[model samples]
Target chain A: MSLIESTATELLGQLQSGRTTAVEIAAACLKQIDRHDAKIKAFLRVDRDGALARAAEIDARRKAGKPVGRLGGLPVAVKDLLCTKGQRTTCGSRMLENFRPPYDATVIAKLRAADAVLIGRTNMDEFAMGGSNENSAFGLTHNPWDLTRIPGGSSGGAAASLAASMVPLSVGSDTGGSVRQPAGFCGVLGMKPTYGRVSRYGLVAFASSLDQIGPLGRSAEDIALLLEVIAGGDPLDSTSVDRPVPKYTESIARPLENLRIGLVREHFGEGLDAEVEAAVREATRVYQSLGATVSELSMPHGKYAVATYYIIAPCEASSNLARYDGAHYGHRTDEKAMAVELAAQRKALQQTGDSRKLEALDNPLIRMYRRTRAEGFGAEVKRRIMIGTYALSAGYYDAYYLKALKVRRLIRQDYDRAFEQVDLIAGPVAPTPAFEIGEKVDDPLAMYLLDLYTASANLAGIAGMSIPCGLSTGGLPIGLQLQAPPFEEERLLRAAHMFQQATDWHTRRPELS
Target chain B: MSISREEVEKVSLLGRLLLGPGELEKMTSQMGQILDYMHLLSEVDTENVEPMAHALDLTNVLRDDTPGVSLPRDEALAAAPHRDDECFLVPAVLGDP
Candidate 1:
């Protein structure tokens, strides 16, 4: 197999044995990206020179018999949402298109410390808003399995890069299933570590409470390896919990005997595609045969996850996005032109004796803010911002935002109750396999529903993962989700690792041109 | 609840976005549809349930009030679209200014 196609663990083995150099692996990955990225559109920026230099440094260290970090020489792709010092971290929006961070995000710093080669920044939904890669301001990332279909998002490019063998491992932020859903669509393993398990110091805020940085890779072990390096507390992020880091890589091989898996009663209901349901059900049966027990567990409030998420996520988004007003950084409107236009409008209204209209047009600063945001944000982003503003508006706060938060508590409570009866919950990651590129672009509700199975984990502050289960009738890949209680990523990884050992599903790659 | 064009425009202004006529119309209907779907939450009785702001029950996490290294002034202003040596440039806040 090509170096680009090898799993991170396999590549690490090759590097350790002196069979392959870091430079060779970096060159191979860059070559793969060069040859196929045009059709895949997975990357927003590829750091060719930087990656090669990093790899050469690793090779030199090894040649000099110096100690290198655990992930030395591994080429990894990062979602553009994570800030990398001196690298353009666009968050897949025109607002930050030319913006580069002054310093690395805590996770990026960890990756660098681990001696990993940061290969490139990947495409994502604008501000990590949409479930489909089509929401990306740059362009949609096509699924490597079926080029006409989306690779799932807002971590679409992260997953696509892995699926297309452009990178052995990639890091992505999961806010309402950004990482896992895309990983599901791309037929790879993705994890959303327990909220606050990984630092969010430089992750551009979407929904702060729901966001968590995680790993995407070809195998469960690879996911665990990356998670081990990046998962920890950072003083920089106040939300990052101060706890001892677990040896995730060391715990992956532990047997999962007597594991109690909860098959969430609501997940297999009306909206779930039959193939996805079957695949997940079969995955449960596999767990059962491995001396594990499966039981039907009811999370009564599970049905309300999507509804509650829509309100809470957008409400938080509005507050988080308020910073982009053409003042501090990002896209700025033509302030001089805006001022002149506002003056003209005020003068026109003054002549017409429309005092009300003139009063509204009086503030040139407000006008500049509006025009800048309108020009900077795309249609969906605008819609979300407006929805959020309305939800949190004076008259509607109790009815919308507060109500959703209460419902969010109920959702979290339901998961806590379900975990009492089971060690982990397994179900379909998304309603169906990968859908076509433009399938749900016009329908925001349909796109939001794509997050139905995944968002509750974020809401509950628990760890969740997606592993390749089976293929749809149309030959698209399906993913089975595994969720665990907060800070129980080791258990989640153990169960997934056990599953992968028994099934060859994760080993199945898309037939790419 | 049906979101009127007036409401959409109002919310857009609050969000600091200037939607065009077409965008205003589309957003009005889309917001109405989303709000209509959100009405499902009302069916559940949450009479005394405490609203959850954070998933983890964390109090205000404070470190010792100690000064540490901060971002260099030049690097911090590097990405600003409109900036001078010391501060970010913006349109006049007051009409007379």
Candidate 2:
């Protein structure tokens, strides 16, 4: 039987049956990347040698009858944001263009322990800032389905890599909709575990409270396999949940009878493309046929999700990214040498009684800090950082940041109430199918609104998954989202699997040629 | 309210991003649009709203002060762009003696 393009589970089964070797799988994937990446541009860096070496080691152990880890021999692509020991981990920014971490992130360590082959680092929006991969300083990662279109982002490269068969599974971080939106755009399975469900220790901080590392793959089962390996607690990440790891793979075969599905009315409201709505509605019918009852629920403040996320995420991001000055790691400038030049400018304004300039010397450290940040971060990242900085600034803290936090609590309460009445919340993952690359790039607010449907989960700190439900009229994939209460990832997986069992959407692949 | 190009430049400087002249103009326009959209938040009556931070209701799950493994000085600095004698070398801070 041909096994070159199977999912992670299918490949694992073949490995168990002695029909394939990890080296063979790794070589085939590397060959696919070599041929497809020129067109798709999914990977930022491909660790060909490292992948083969790891795959060979896995094969060697299997030959010696050694016990293997869960995802042993699976080729996995990692978003560049995660640290990989001795590997260039540029979070798609020129600032840390050549910075390599001396250690692996806790998730990477877990994947390594599971014997997964580290295939490569995929591109992302610089510092995971923009909604579209166009913000990547390296280059835009194209949608595998339609080369001229964007592969959703900031996990665009990760999603594109999987869509192109460059790798069967990849890791992505979702803060706001980084993972899910991209997965929806690329027509693949992407999941963001509960806020602390997966360790965020090695993920280069974007929005600390919102950032979550999760898997992207061709199918829900593949995501389950990867999540099983990556989920759990770690001392390195204080927020990581210290709960018993759920048997996600085992849940894949569970029955879906009497499941309660909540259709969030706010997500289906205006701005959602008719085609995307149809696709989700079709998936809902399939779930209903599987004996899951669907009901309409309301998250009235849902429209405020993106607005609230912009304030909270950027505020947290501004604080978290403060460590990246040239003094610590990544890019730095000779601010001290440039100080004389800066002071002159500051003094010129001071003499004019320009309160703006007069306030400058009050804190030269602020000047240096602002200069380093201004020079290092990207436009979108900077805008959010500034918004966050202003919100948390001495005068505006109680009004903006603090208020956003309170509204965020209300948003979380909204989700908590909905879950009590439903087994899972289901909706369209994005408002529309993948749009053209530059369609929303010029309009930042237009782009931010794209995460309206996906950002609520981050606000509520709940587990969410996006599965390919169907194709839009334009022939792009539409993602159907499913979410569950905290630590209920297994139920979320079971419900998604049930829907998958009734439809062939997950089995479809984008035209790569 | 229109956010001027000058304001965008000020914010950019505060955030540490070096934008080219063209990028600055683009960002100014984009940030102005985003800010306009964000103005809607002011309409929401959040006078008594409690801001949310951590997702779970779980309070600070702090561990007792305990000794933990520390990275070796050399190992930690192995990835430093420039290092010397157990210290990371950076551009000298001019004001510091």
Candidate 3:
């Protein structure tokens, strides 16, 4: 086993025992990153000096016999979407490439309070838009399992870094399967905490309602530990749940016997790969052997998840992204040119005997706004923004945006009904395993389909997890998904932990080193 | 499901994104194909259903309308790409007077 395979709990135990110093373990991870990051390209930027200094301080505290928190001294990889004070928290977008925040996100603050070493920011899809890390303006983050294949995304780099053994635990955001899908492809545990279970104050927005911060790690236990520190209400984020936070790590140790597991029939339909279905079936058998009852559950509304998500996510995205229009916080261009070039041209056109009254040509502010946005965002980002703008536009809001909202309601209702008959839902995280780097890039629809099984959780605001169940025939990893109703993350974790105990797939590490 | 290059250009304009003629053609085709796949949502019955915006059952969680701490003017303006004395300056958005 590689040093990266060391679970967060085991590493914490070693730290408390004085068998391993924080500096030693952190240096080891940094060395591994230096040795292997070139081929993997998992990191957007590594805070070598900051990380080392922090580790040294923690080591000093340990030597002084100072009390440390549960995850003290362990390194954690953070996806680029989470804001880190004084660090360039670029959300894989050129628009904010140099943007740094004055305050730390609530999750980052909690991790620091727990003494978890902040290692670095991982790469991701620009603005968390694509299914593959290929959308990142910095570079693509390769899957450690197969360098040529994608690591899934927009949390692709976080999953890759963990799978490559650069870090034991990493944090990622899931707007639509960003964490879980990549976690599956990288052969790790990725959890999308129930919406509002974790604070979103520091996370850069994608789809406001759909966006969530999650943990990606080697196993359910590591995620459980991270979630404990990160979960709870924060005054900084109004959306954070004020409900009581459960003892996640303790709950994960609970046995899974006589628990009802549902297999969503729609998820295993025609498009699913034979290998993926087989792996999910095998996982179901394991659950059955653990004294759990597995039953096939019908979720006919699940067939519309992709469609519903596309409309709803974009509509939210268009509004959330409106804050970046060459104003208050982000990139802005030259003013003189804006007045002389764009403004004068419009003025001249308006002065002329134009028949259409230069309605579109009348407003130079609008023109400048258009040019700035056009220059700033990528293709996929632009497409979604336009679709959203159109959906919410004057004439079509009732037909497109409002109708999508109603459908989203039906979709959630379907899950609520399903949960009535079963304690949790189980299926393959994705329809297939990881595809090639550029396989679905040209086909946006095909890329969106990758979230077929995962987006429903985001839509319904329930907890979902992806754990490595088996490997595909093509040598890529497949994740078996287990979902629970709101605030039932403990149950979801328990079921996943039981399945993990019966298999060795979670222990398998990609040979990136 | 079918989007043309002209439609792509129009959409790009609406989105405030500049796309070259070539990119417009490519994106139109790509988005069309993607939209075709997304039409599956229409297959479900959504009649008389109330739209769900958020997952949590709680509502009206907005902060009270009292004044709160605000960032210093200079500190907020410090990160702007371009700035002037006492304010974040951008190209005159209203155009020349």
Q: Pick the candidate with the highest lDDT.
A: 1
TM-score of B chain for each model? 0.91, 0.81, 0.79
All predictions: root-mean-square deviation over Cα?
1.1, 2.9, 2.3
- Among these predictions, the greatest TM-score belongs to 1
Better of 1 and 3 by lDDT: 1
In order of appearance, the predictions have TM-scores of 0.98, 0.93, 0.95
Q: Sort the candidates on DockQ, descending order.
A: 1, 3, 2
User: In model 1, which residue pairs have backbone atoms overlapping below 3 Å?
Assistant: none
In model 3, the clashing pairs are A335-B91, A374-B16, A374-B17, A374-B18
The TM-score of predicted model 2 comes to 0.93
Instruction: Give stretches of model 2 more than 4 Å off.
Output: A334-372, B2-29, B62-66, B81-83, B89-97
Best by DockQ: 1
Write one digit per residue (lDDT tens) for candidate 3, span A228-264: 8899987887788998888988878889667999998
lDDT per residue, candidate 2, A116-234, as tens digits?
99999999999888777998888989999999899988999999888887788999999988899889888789999999999998789988888999899987788889999999998
Report how large a share of the reference interface contacts model 1 reproduces. Answer: 0.90
The CAPRI classification for model 2 reads as acceptable
How big is the positional error of residue A81 in model 3, measured in Å on the Cα after superposition? Answer: 1.1
**What C-alpha lDDT do the candidate models reach, one value each?**
0.90, 0.83, 0.84
